[model samples]
Structure formats: C-alpha cells, structure tokens
Target: MRRLSTIIALFISLSAFADEGMWMLGNLNKQSRQTMKELGLKFPADKIYNPKKTSLTDAVVSFGGFCSGVVVSNDGLVFTNHHCGFSAIQQHSTLQNDYLQDGFVARTHEEELPNPELFVRFLLRTENVTPRVLKAITPGMTEQDRQAITDSIMYAIQDEIYAKDTTLVAVVDPYYGGNEFWLSVYRDYTDVRLVFAPPSSIGKFGWDTDNWVWPRHTGDFSVFRIYAGKDNKPADYSPENVPYHPPYVVPISLAGYKEGTFSMTLGYPGTTERYLSSFGIEEMMNGMNQSMIDVRGVKQAIWKREMERSDAIRIKYASKYDESSNYWKNSTGTNKVIRQQKILERRREMEATLFRWIQDTPAERENLLHLFSSLELNYKARREAGRAMAYFGESFMNGPELVQLALEILNFDYEAEEKMVMSRMKKLLDKYANLDLALDKEVFTAMIKEYRSQVDSLYYPDFYATITDEYNGSDHAFIDSLYAQTKITTPLGLKLFFEQDSTYNIFEDPAISLSIDLLVKMFDIHQVIQEPSTNIERDERLFNAAIRRMYANRNFYPDANSTMRLSFGTVRGYTPFDGAEYDYYTTTRGIIEKAKAHAGDRDFTLEPEVLDFLSSRDYGKYANTDGDMSVCFISNNDITGGNSGSAMFNANGELLGLAFDGNWEAMGSDFIYEPDLQRCIGVDVRYMLFVMEKLGKADHLIKELNLR
Candidate 1:
C-alpha cells in the first residue's frame, strides 16, 4: 500500500505536465509555461492570458452562468454544448413550433429568439487577492471568524466595483482549500439569443445512455448570439439590441487532431476534491452520491412513465427529466469507479504517508497534528446527518414540481393586499407553469414515502405526524387530502379563490403547512451538521497546506471552484481493462452503426433525415484524413461539470472541439485524478460545423465563423 501510494504521488508529479491540474491563468508559472512550449504551444504564455491586452481568455465566456463557451466571431456568436443551451431552448419551445424537438435556426437577426434570463460573461481580469484576504486572520481565530473576515473584505472590494457598474460581476474565490484567494471580475452580457440548434435527435443523440461514455456520436453543440446596447455594453433584452462585438474572437481550425496532438481546454470547471481527506471521499461515495442515485432513480422512472403518455407532458418535463437523469447517472458511475479502484483505501494509504512525514519532525507534528484528528472526529460525527441531508434534498426539495412551487410560496410576500398577493402567487406559479398536476401528485406521494423509509423518524418533516395519526400512515391518503384542500389544484377553484381572496388565508392551507414542515426539517438537519462540517472544512484546509509543504518540489493545483482555468494534455486514448484498448477518436461510421444497432431505442433514435445524412458517403468539410467525419475525440484535459461547452484548442491555439464530457472509467477522478484512465470527451469542431451547415441548413451562421 505504501509503495502504491508513493508510485501514485510520483505519477501525479509526472502527470502534472500531461493532464492533471486546472491551472490558474492569472498566475501561469514559468515551469508550466516551459512545459507547454515543449509540448508545442505556438505562442508564449501571454497569448493564453495577458491582463493588459485581449487574449484567448477574452474569447471564452461563462455561458449562462453555469457552463463555458467561446466567441467564434467578432459579432459574439457563441458556441456552447447543446445541453448548456438546452434549458433556454426548452423555455422558448411551444407545441406549435417545438424548438426542442424540431430545432431552431434564425435566418435573420430579427428572427433570433431572445432568452432574457440567459447571459454569457467574459473574464475581464483575475487578480490574486490572497494578501488582502489573509491579512485579517488572527492566529487562534475559529474557522467561522476567519471566513467572516474574508467575506467582509471580499464584499468591500466587490461592493466598491458594484457601486460604479452593477453589471460588472466580481467574485473572490478561495483556492488550494482556502489557503489562497483570487478575485475574478467579469463583464456579463445578458441579452443572449438562440441562433441555431440541431434537433434533439442529433444534439443529444444517445441521451443518458451515451452521456459520459467514450466514442460518443452526439453532436452536442448549439449556437447563440450575445446582444448588447448600441454601445456594445450589457443591456436587458430588447428588439433594438444589436449583436455584441467582442474584444476578441477565437478562430476555428477545420484541420482535425492526430492521436498524440497537443490539446488544451480553458473553462470554468465546477468543483473537485483532490485534496479532500479519505474520510470525506468515503462519505461522498456512501452518503451523498448514494442518496442522489437512489432518489433520482425513482423520480426518473415516475417522470418517464408520465412523459411517455402525452406529448404535452413530455415537452413540459423534458428539461426536468434530463437534468435529473444526467447527474443520477454520473453519481452511479462515480460510486462504481470508487469501489472498483478501491479509491477510499488508496486515499487512506496516501494519508498514512502524509501523517508519517508530519511525525518525522516535532515542529511539523506540533503544527499539523490536529488535521487528521479533527478530520476523523468531525467526519464521523456528521456521517449520518450528512446522509440525511442528501436524502432530504433529493426526495423533498427536488422530487415533485409542486413541492418546489410550495417552497416558492413559503418565501412569498403575502402581506400585500388581496389582489396583489393573488397576482404574485399566479406569477410565481407561472414560473413552473408547465408542471402536470397529476404527475406532480404521483411524485409527491412517492417522495414522502421514500423519505420516511430511508431516514430516521427524528429527521421526518412535522407533516409526517399528520400522515401517521390522521391518515393511518398512508402517504397517498395524506397527499390526496393536501391537494384536495388546495384551491390552486383545480382551475375553477383557483379562479374563484383569486376572485375572492380577502377572506382566504393560504398560510393556514394544508399544502402550505406541509411545505413549512419540509423547510423546518431541512433547517434542523443543517443546524445539527453545522459545527462538525465547519471543523471538517477547517481541518481539510490545514491538511491541504501541509501536503503542499511536504511536496515542495511537486506542482499542486487548486481544486476547481467554477473559475476560469486551463488544463492541457495530448489527444490520446487508453486501455480501460486488461485487454481492451480504446481509440482516441470516434468517426461518423460509429453513428450509423449505433443508430442501426439501437434503431427503435429512444436514446439512439435519430431523425430519418439525420440518419440518411449520416448514411450518405461524403462527410465533406468535416472529414478527417481517412475521409470520415470525426464525431468526438478523447484527451486527458482536467475538466468537470462547468467545463461543458469550453473550447478545446490545439497547440497552435486554434479550436479543435468542445470539451463536453469525461470518460466514465474516470468519473471518480473529481476526487482522485486517474492518470491512466482519465480522458476528456469532446465533440469535434468539424462535426459541429457539418451538422450546422449540411444537416440544419444554417449556411448563414456557418459562414459567420472565422474558419481557418
């Protein structure tokens, strides 16, 4: 075990140059730059990130605050993952013109559909704010106090900027497990509009089945244009808004990638726990991930059954179902990898060395002894509560659509006069306007029963007593009574209730009471776990600092926190098991093979036109040297959730593809980087162009790209 740990640590040192760290752009070290150059970086490090001028970083945008994207033309034409733009596409969809089903392509600027809530933000600057953040920390201050001091300083810095221009978003994020801090200031353009999207059949070809899998045929690309005021500044959605002209636009390389070609991805990777203690990783595997997998399985099954019954229901629940299933499937993969690889035991072995190093010197032992002790204690203390929290969140907060609506009502300002309060409630309900009452009723009942069965009686919502005493422990009966008493469930009742609201008190309603109980129970769990969780967080931070000191000669990258970062590697494949070797790229032939193999399958079902198109011989402009179109390829770039839609660039700093997913074999790499198996799955840029131009017939949008 010690030998294995030492080998892994050494491999991580070597792999740092291959595809390990999500490096900070603001502080590109000399050592990293030289390595990148040796690997075929065409320009200097400044070309990738330069604070004084527009660099490749300027072209990258945080898509709708959740995913990453790149500006492909001077007019701010953004290319992101189809999934990243899915929510907006679904929102704009209607039965009359189903964009989600049939796809949308605007022929002219005027025809483009506006997404008011969606925005893409550019990285204006990233500054090291470590000194400012750490200066106020006292020697013996509690973690909470230290955090409060950090927050005050961060707020003061951001508030000063906000006073000048509210559109300028500034966030001070902790790095290296709060050992250091950096501030990222961004320019957010909110008037983003959909320009082109392929039908779901192409954009999301294999759906959940193909997600996180290698050799993917999913096109997984969407196009949107950022709109700004006449001055090219951020503005609200309006008919008069013009296409945003960006400071820089990334050039698309039509040339494809070789197996060992140098590749890099720059994006906002959501989170990673590479420095997390073994105890924390085990908790994540057995507790949070397990609860998510179990609860979402039930929810997806229920939603799928309901959705298949009616087109109306399908359209209403498409986004909800996909969101749930994607993560649900991801959690299952993470746990599988953790167990198969014995990740928990390996982590413990690594920690053993870390502790042994601490004990070698009395000075080191004196300073860092609390790390393991406190982490072990608090992690054990919070184990059950943490699992309960995950179950409560999955089953209660995210289960039923009406349950979410109930939460919204809980926060509603009911103090307004009758008509105002009624209007507000109607508006709030409209936020989830597509929810099917029947489907929600079924889901809500099942969730209540599932929660009760999974968790202890102490964690039960106060409303559980009503189900037990009044309804004889019948979830269906209790749920039925709640809905029956709520006027909003029926159109006529809602209308009448809205008409005469002066005498009505919704706070006394059964449904409202049930929501309150859910909130109160969630709060109780949070309260119980707060102290222990804090201790664990503090211990982890101390552990992270100590590990860095121990490995002073080795490179240590901070765990991702949804900030702009760059990760580099080669376009290479790997052997997953004893005898099986995977290719670096999957061609168009695989698409036809998959479509035919799973002809009647919903996930593999492609539109007849798309099938015929793939079946036809010539891949034309997108074809590689073998005269076959590249669908997707694999690399070892470190990426996570938010890296979806990020531009994958070749050594020449030209676009190769879009970083969309990570291979399933390395799903647990978020906690522990699997140097041998970890590979980034990306949709070939040429494939995206082929779909946009040949399949979608969006030549105007295709022509707008600065193709090389």
Candidate 2:
C-alpha cells in the first residue's frame, strides 16, 4: 500500500493564511489554537474539548443527524434554528391548532410537545482507528474487495466498542478520504420535546425570499428540551422521563458584539467538496445543479398554488415546500456563484500547479497523473447518467406524493401490507384532503418531458415507449390517465384496491406500474454508471490521500461528514458587490422597515402583536446599549447546511447566537471557500430572549437560560 506523506507535503507547500476550514473538535492542534487566539478566541483549546471533563463540545449535539444544537440550561434545554425544527413543528400542527402559524410556547413542562422520532446525540469520545482498519487492505486489491474487508473490520471494531458500552452509538468515519479513519461514540437521547417557537411571522420572517440574503431580520430560532430517564441516560419518550442534566450548558451573553468581535461556531456541518477537481465542479454546476433547479422549480410552482388555496394544505406541505425550496435556491445560488467566482478556472489553475509539482517529483508523477486522468474520464462518462438520475429524483420520486406511496405499497407482502396500506391511505386523506390531482398531473407531465428531453433516448424507461406508442407521445394525457386509474390517488380507491384477494397484482395499477418501471430504469442507469462511479470514488480517495501527504506539516481538517466541528472567526460585514456595504447585524428597526416595505406579503408581514411591540420600542433587557433590539448578525465563521442551529459563541465562550444560513454570494463556499465573501448568518441570542419575554411572554422559559 502507498503512503500519503508525499501528498501532505505538497499540500503544505501550497497552504496560505485563510480561515477556510471546519476543524474537528477532538482533533484540534497547536496551530489551530494559535490561529483561534489570533482571531480573538479567549478560551484554551483544551477547555473547548476535553474528554475526561465537561467541555464546550459536551454542550453541542447533533440534532437528528441533520443539524446542530446547543444545550442551554442545566435541565437539558436545547437551542437551534426554527428551520432545523420545522418538520417537528409541522408534524404537531393542524388547522384547529396551527402551531406553525401561531407558534407554541410550553408554559409548563407538561405543555411541551413530544416528537415521535426526533433525537439529539452528544459526542462521547473519538479514537484513531486508521491503522487497525487499513491493515485489512492489500496492494492491488479490487475496490469491491477493499470495501468489503474495510466494512468487516469497521463493523467488528464497532461491535467491540458497543460490547463495552451498550449506550453508545459507535460510528467509523473516513477522513482525508480513506487515508485516515476515526471511531466516534455518541449517546443519542431520543426523548426530545418542543419547548418554544415563535410564530412564522418571526421565525420564518422573510421565508424563501430572504433565505440566503444577508442583513436579515428573521429571528430564526427554536427551543427544544431533552428528556432522559431518572438515571440520566438515553431513553424513549415517556412521562416519567425528566429534563436531562447535561455535562455543560452554553451561557447566554447579552453583551452585543460589533464588527471585528471575535466569534466561534461549534456544530455539525453536513458536507463540502473543497478538494474537488475542475471536472467534478463542471459536472456539478452544469449537470446536477441545473437539473435539480429546473425540476424543483416545476414542483414548487404546483405546490405553492395548492398550499395557498387552503390553510390545511399549507400546513401539510409547509415543511416539504421549505425543504424543496431550500435546495432549489441552493442549486441556483451555487451555479451563479460558481460562474461569478470563476471557480472552475481557479480549480484548473490549482490542478495545473499540482501537475507541475508532481512532474518535479518523478517518483509520484505517474501515479498522480493517472489518478487525475481516471477521475476526469469517470466524470465525463457519468455526466449524462448523473443528469438522468437527478431528473428521476425530481420527477417520479419526489414530484407527486402518490407515486411514492404506490412504490412503498409495492414493496410489502400482501399479508403484511394491509395495515401499512391502510395507515398510508388515512394519512394521505388527512394531510392532503384538498388533493390537487390536476396540479400533480401537470407537474408529473412536465417532469417526464424534462427527463425525456435531457436524458438520452437509449436510457429512456420502458414506459416511455408505452406513452409514445400507446398514448401518442402526450405525457399530460398519460399522467392524467394514470391519476384517474391509480388506486392511491384517493382513500376510496386505495381501500377498494386493498379489498382485493391475495391473487391481486399491484402492478396492474397505473401508478404502481409507472413507479416500478421508473425504478427499474433508474437501476439500469445505475448499473451503466457503476464502474465509472466506483473508479471515481477510488481515484478521489487516492487524490485526497495524496493531498494529505503533501501537506503533512500543515494543520488539515476533514470535509464535514455530518460530524461535530468547531469553526472560529470574527463579526465582520462585507461588500458583496461594489458600492454595496452591509452592516454586521440587523435590528428590529430593519424588520419594521421590511414589514412596511412589503406590507400584507406573507413573507414580510409581522404578527399584529409583534408589530405593536415594535411600534412602542419596548425591548427592555433584550435591547442593546444603543436602545435597539438586535435580530440577526453575521460572522465570518465557516459553516454549511448542517451547521444550522449551531451555537455561535463569543470570545469568552458564551452563547452569542444560533447559526442559521450562509450568505448567497458564498454559496460556492461549500466547494471553494471564499474567506472574504463567505459569512454565517445567525439569530442573536438577545433577539431570542426578546421574543420569549416581550413577544412570546414566555419569561418562564427565558428564566431557564444562564444569562450573562
């Protein structure tokens, strides 16, 4: 097996001074500490992450594996972004009790709503398991064989760890690609409850329109409480479970920060491809992103119309719309930033430099050159299949809700499928009572057209031929017919279909038939691209290993894989474009201004009570020294999708805000960090306190926080 030392050295040679990486909590080095100190971090590195003693890392939790949250009170109060908890809020919402629209404030512990599957995981510890795992691989081993051996070893290690501690959820993650591996053990608390949330007027103040925009006034915060058994251990939701006493809780700081104030963010960042080659970037920008944007645009258009028609439909699809629009806008912003920033050209330049450096080192030249060539070829070969897959994802898989239900029903046995089918039918009827068959039909039709036009004819599903020959090439007519003939479209049809005998064939249903055919086509495409995708992964692993070796002396952080990480920076604003400067923070005054500018607009309209409070300027203790109520603030802290709900701390490690969104101009920061432009948007802690006390009138909940 080849070593990665050479590549690390090469990477070190190219390193420069820039705060651009997500440093893992347990792996901070002396240089990282020094950098943090220079950037205004007042706490020692050990104080931030000490396995033997309670530290800041103990306060941070992986919120259901998708977002980050912080423990705020001794009694297990957790703080995160409202968007992070939106799905839970949606689940508990209904027309009679619209928690999403009016928000919910648990005045007493008994009032807190329980979530069925929500969880918060705290890191126990991490150990380097690279050598033990790598011992399984040998030179010239096939990728499949290598993966199998690695998995077996990893599972064995995890089992060994679990044997000693049954409470721990053990996971092994590869860092620097497969060059290094670490075992992370976590204690997952399953009994999480919604404590408090501001109405959508404040929580989702600007909604989709101001999603990634800066100078934002949205108070995008939500509160949840973690419950544990009497033993203070993880347990299922039960009335007997009490508020958990965490090892540490973040102390809220009302001392407002200004431009250049030191700040740090600790959370789980989902993913980044900072080491991607220009070939990969081109494929992502032109193929995957474009397909998602186009397809989701069509889906969202239909959903918006149905949702606006009634409050019930709006409640049913609020989370779905938010989730879909988030990435739709992300794809749009990323493509725009990629072009505007000339990221491809920059990557090409870096590749050129790397190649030149490799050539000088004859020992490494051939291997490095072969890796890049193979990667480029693999990406080129799979671009079309990738685009086709993206379209399939956006269309039949995610376009209409009924298609997914039909596919799920097909997966179950007749004897066991009845209960599942009945439950699904009830849910479908209850949630989507205003089922817009015509709108869904239109969306499905448009998506199918997109897939046919974008993907090659050779890759078309068998049903395409059925539509073209039997239905006369009319997707609209075919989809309309499918809806009319499908059992899952309505509760009566579904119940009637389930009444059939064991001899009944689900494939006879039009929706089920189309779904199965599409699934088969997707499988076929996957088979076609399997080899190339495998080769790409293998080459990327090698490439990452080489980079690690080249930068051996420099402090390197792994790309975020939904694990806890700490990123530090300062509170500073930027000029995203020439002659347009933004302030470091937004205040309640700005919210009022925006409300006035877009009065009656759903996205900008404030609740009448909130409007009245703003009119009187009665912020009380939550007001800044300047007599203004701070809402949102921006920091140069590096963050991504999963960092939402992460704790933004001041120099003294006091809670400053909850990290939410990143600036639009820095959308490409996931792939290529633009230090000057990339900024983390957070809802200030003061704003949360103000909303809880003055607006929400939940001073009891506010009293739980250790305010400074």
Candidate 3:
C-alpha cells in the first residue's frame, strides 16, 4: 500500500488539470481573469451546492443529450436537447405523421404524445451519512468483516428510513477514503411525457459529422412535462394527474450573453476524477486507451464489414456504431494529448510537494503514511475489480433474474451471505424449470472455467472440478448423482453445496447466480475495507479542508449537490483541437441553409413541411439577435450531463434560449470547467414559439410559453 503522503501528492496534481479539475469557489485565485459574481449574478439560496444542505432533489429535466429545458409550468415540463428528444420524436413518428423524419406539434393538449422509457428525475435530497454509516465498523477491518458490518448497518438504516416513503431511497457515495460518506436521495417519477419536439430537420441540422465538431448550427432542444397527483407532490402517472407547478422557474429574457459575460451552470455535474493518483491516471491512459482501441477498432471493423453486406443491420446499429467510433477516435486523440503533456509527471511532483508540506507541519501531522499505504493496496485491488465488473456488466450480460437474485443476496450482511444456504435451495427449483437446458449447461461450464483461470484459484477450486464432466453434456447426470449422494436434492442443498461444501458437482447451478454473489461480495469488500484504505477519506478531508479555507478567505458558500445550482457565464466561444476558432453563435438561417444542402441521409434530411415553413420566412415569435432576429443561439455556461433541460436566463432571469449542447472541445468540462472551450447552445424560446405558432400552426404551445 502506498503512503498517505504519496496518495495526497498524486491527488493534488491530477485535480489541477485541464478538464476534471475543480475551481476554487468565489473567484479567489481566478479573479484576475474574470469571476461569476462580476456578471451581476445571483445564485438562488436553494440552488447553491452546499455539502451540508444535503438534497439535490431537482435534476435538470433533460430530453436526449443535447437539448436544454427548464421545469417550467412545473407539472414537470422538461425542456432539453432536441436531439435528446429524438427518441420521443421517433416514438410519435408514424406513416401518417412521422415526427422524427418530419416533426409535429400539438395544437391542442390532446394532441400531445407520450413515449416509452422517457422520464425525468427531481433530486429530492442528499445526506451526509458519514457518522451513522462509519460507526458500524472502524478502519482496518478485514474485507469479509467489513462487508458484513456495512451490509447489516446499511440495511437496518435503510429499512428504518425507506419503510416510510418508497420514494425516499438511498445510494451510498464513498468520499475521502473510508472516513466520510454521503447518501443521495431521489424522487423518481417514471411517467414523463413529451410536450413538444421540432422536426429533426430543424433540430439536428448537421447530424454525426457535425456533432462534437460544431461550427455549429443545431437547435437541439425538446420539451416534456411531469405529472403528479393533485396534491402537488410526486406520484405515479395516472389519468387524473395534472401538470406540476414548480416553486421557481427561470423567466426567459430577450437579453442575450455577450463575450466575456459571466455565466453559471446550475445543474449536477456528474463526477470529477481530479483527485486521482498519477499511477491511476497512467493506468487509465494506458489500459483504458488500449481497451478502447481494441474494442472500438474491432467493432468498427465488424460494423463496416456488416454495413457493406447488410444495410438493415447498418441502420439498426447506426447510432451505436457511430457512438463507438466517435468514442474511440476522440479517446485516441485525448489520450495522446494526455500522454505527451507529461500530466502524470507533474502530478507526481505535486504529490511530493504536498507530502513535504504535511511532514513539516507538526500541528496537523498524525502519521497518515500508513493510511496512504493502505490506499495504494486498495487501488490495486480496485483496478482488478473494475476489469471484472466491466466484463460482468457488459460482456457476460447476466440475466435479469440472476441479477435480482444477486442483489437480494447482497442485501444481507456477511452472516447472511454465509447462512442463506437454504434460501438458495428454494430458488433453485424455480430457476431450474426456466433454464434453457443447453444454454445453461454451456454457459455454466464456460463460466467456471473462466473463473478458475482469472479469479484467485484457491477460492474457487470446486468450480474447475466440474469442467470436464459438464463439457461432455453430462451436466444433468452429474447433478442427479450429486443429489443422490448428498440426500440434498432440494435447491437449498445445491446452493449450500456451492456456498459451503464445494466437494460436489455445483456446476449444474447457474453461473449468473454465483456471479451475482461474487459481485456483491466484491462491492461489500470495496465499500467496507478497500475504499477506506484508499484516498476516499483523505480526499474528503482535503476537500473539506479546502472548503474551510475558502470560507475563511472569501466567505463563499461552499458548493454542494443540492436541488438547484445557479452558475452564470456568457455566450463566448474558443479554439479547439487544431486551433480552430469558434465564434459565439449559430443562427436560425443556418438550419435552413444546411437543409438546402443536405444529401439524402436518415439523420440528415429536411422535413418537407419544415422546409416550406422556412421558405416562407415568417419569423413569427422569433427574437432578433441584434436587429436581425435569429432562432437558435449559444451561451457559455458550464453544464454537464445532469444539467439537461436547464433554463438559460438573461440579467433579470428572463428566458433567453434553451441551452442544449456544449462544443466538443468542452466534453472535458465534465471533469473540468473550461471557460474558453465550453459553450452552452440552446434554442431561443422565441424561435421555438415562432416555429410552433407559424410553422407548426400550434398557437396553443405559443400561448403556453405565455408570450402574449
């Protein structure tokens, strides 16, 4: 295990990078350039990210990946990526209407459509569960013991809390080594419906070739509404439900952002790996890069071959193929940049500096070196575990039933993991009846063989024992013989055999069931022991320390993952990749021009109806940028995955455009907030209203926008 000093050094360096680095709050160090506060900005008290506040209940309601919308007229009206809304567009698509290919508008409320698996989540709350959780077992607990203790304590806590409101759920987040923890709560509403979507021709003017690389003109925004019971609280979708009214929704503005203007992104920015060790970063750069190259390259080769042979398959996997290719290609470029820049070397130096500082300070020195060593050990374990987890999640594709079974098993503590032998028997009979005999036999045989090869062989010698007999298609015979000998023909007996007594032919049992158990154990091991040993606690301590430092220095409110966050920025652009400069704007006319030049491709065709509307040049509800009103526009707000459907507002918090995509150069914004490269693009509510009112002839929606 690496020492605490070593890990801290690595952590500080990585966190100071280009994309994933977190900026200190309140512009203390950054004031020389610009600050969010300078732009006449005010973040709502409710929206601030305060670790102590503990509830990020409101997630930016988003449709697809690109669009931006706010939860206005609250019955959960989510405005988001137009491309994000594409699936819903396709769902409403038909021979008669073909919304995806054409686009449609709901003239009346009755004409509004619903799509499958489309929903929005409002972050209900978050909790710092550090004391309550860590109280179960102290640091340095054994893996098995740690797993058992955590499960027992966590289950007890959740059962006590969640029993009241099913909506009140919890997910544990390991922070700062094992010293700190957080529990995120969510109010999940599954019944989300599409309120409006423009035709794809207008929404995705340029498609894949133009996706990340944007000169860029795509009005990618869509709208959906959330429904709940009459009491204004969350409830499942029902015929009696009504539109949710949000307590606060941003008001749209005709005023737009100027270059150098300050902006704020007030939504959840998923995760930051800024605190990783230099070793960790190198592994990813080397390991993940190689993996991407292998998988994506192979997949691309296969896809291209299949595309030549089967057009139908090509169309079916078109999105996936493009996504994989883009991921690999971009990753290749990103990795190269990461490697050549000596990012790892710089980070190592930073770690050493921090260590020297810590060692010099006797007042705070608590001999954290042992703790750091433990962290290094855990990192090694985690890397191995990650590989295993990836294979299990994607490649193996465990059956839903087995997944459920595994979750159920892990729901219990260590004693439960060992003692639930009989429960396995009861489940076996039911599962056996459903298993496809041939598939099960083959799958089980292969799984055991693989486990024996990859997993610690000492823990799984019995799995390898059955490989020979099972391969000859004698699995059933072996199972019957084992049952006869053990006098434990029940499913419980079979499970006990696998769990406790590994002498028999447990090979007949499902691999998924065993895999699930293994995975649960792995998670338990990680959370309870390994995670504590690593940087989780140290990171938390550092972050909290940093926060305290900021509070003392600037009196800034510490950032938290609360229900809302208001980040203010401006509408500026920058140069990316090869020094290609991007100006801060794309106009409505750009959409029309792109449509005119389109070659025939499913992702890139103009709907005749929309073309006709564009040809007419009506500009009904469109707000003019300067004297010439343009429909779609851009801003420079630092938003990521969780900020979908967030409203972009002007000085008085009036609606500007609905924010959608960030420039490709800003994908790194997920890890780091870059003022220069990151740009938030949105559809002007004015243009959206214009399209609905004039082109789609849907005065009803225009009326809904309340733009009398």
C-alpha local distance difference test of each model: 0.85, 0.84, 0.51
Write candidate 2's Cα lDDT for 1-708 as tens digits.
Answer: 122544443343245344668987777878888888998888767889888998999999999889999999999999999999998898889899998999999989999999856899999888889999999788899998988888898899999988998999999988876778899989999999998988998999999999999989888989999999999999877999999999898898988898999889999999888876778789888776887788898889878888888887799789989999999999999999999988887676666666666777777785676777888899989988887787777776887776767775666455556645555555544445545567667777777887777778887888788888989988877877888777677766566565764555667878888788888888988998899988887888887767666557766778888888888889999999989998899888898999999987889988787788777888888888989888899988889999999999999999999999999999998887776788999999998988888878898888788999
What is the per-residue lDDT of model 3 for residues 142-190, given as tens digits with 9 covering 90 to 100?
Answer: 5567657666766776676677777765556554333455565545555
Q: Listing every candidate in turn, what is its Cα RMSD in Å to the true structure after a full C-alpha superposition?
A: 2.7, 3.9, 9.4
Off by over 4 Å in 2: 1-18, 411-438, 492-504
Model 2, poorest ten-residue lDDT window?
A: 1-10
> Which sequence of candidate numbers ranks them by lDDT, best first?
1, 2, 3
What shift in Å separates residue 138 of candidate 2 from its native position after superposition?
A: 1.6
For candidate 1, lDDT tens digit of each residue in 190-249? 889999998998899899899889878888999999999999998878898899998888
For model 3, the stretches where C-alpha displacement exceeds 4 angstroms are 1-36, 42-69, 74-76, 90-97, 123-186, 288-337, 340-342, 363-366, 370-565, 577-580, 592-604, 625-635
TM-score of each: 0.95, 0.93, 0.67
Error of 1 at 506 (Å): 2.8
- Pairwise lDDT winner, candidates 1 and 3: 1
Order of quality (TM-score): 1, 2, 3
Candidate 1 vs candidate 2, TM-score winner:
1
Judge candidate 3 at residue 587 and give its lDDT: 64
Candidate 3 lands at a TM-score of: 0.67
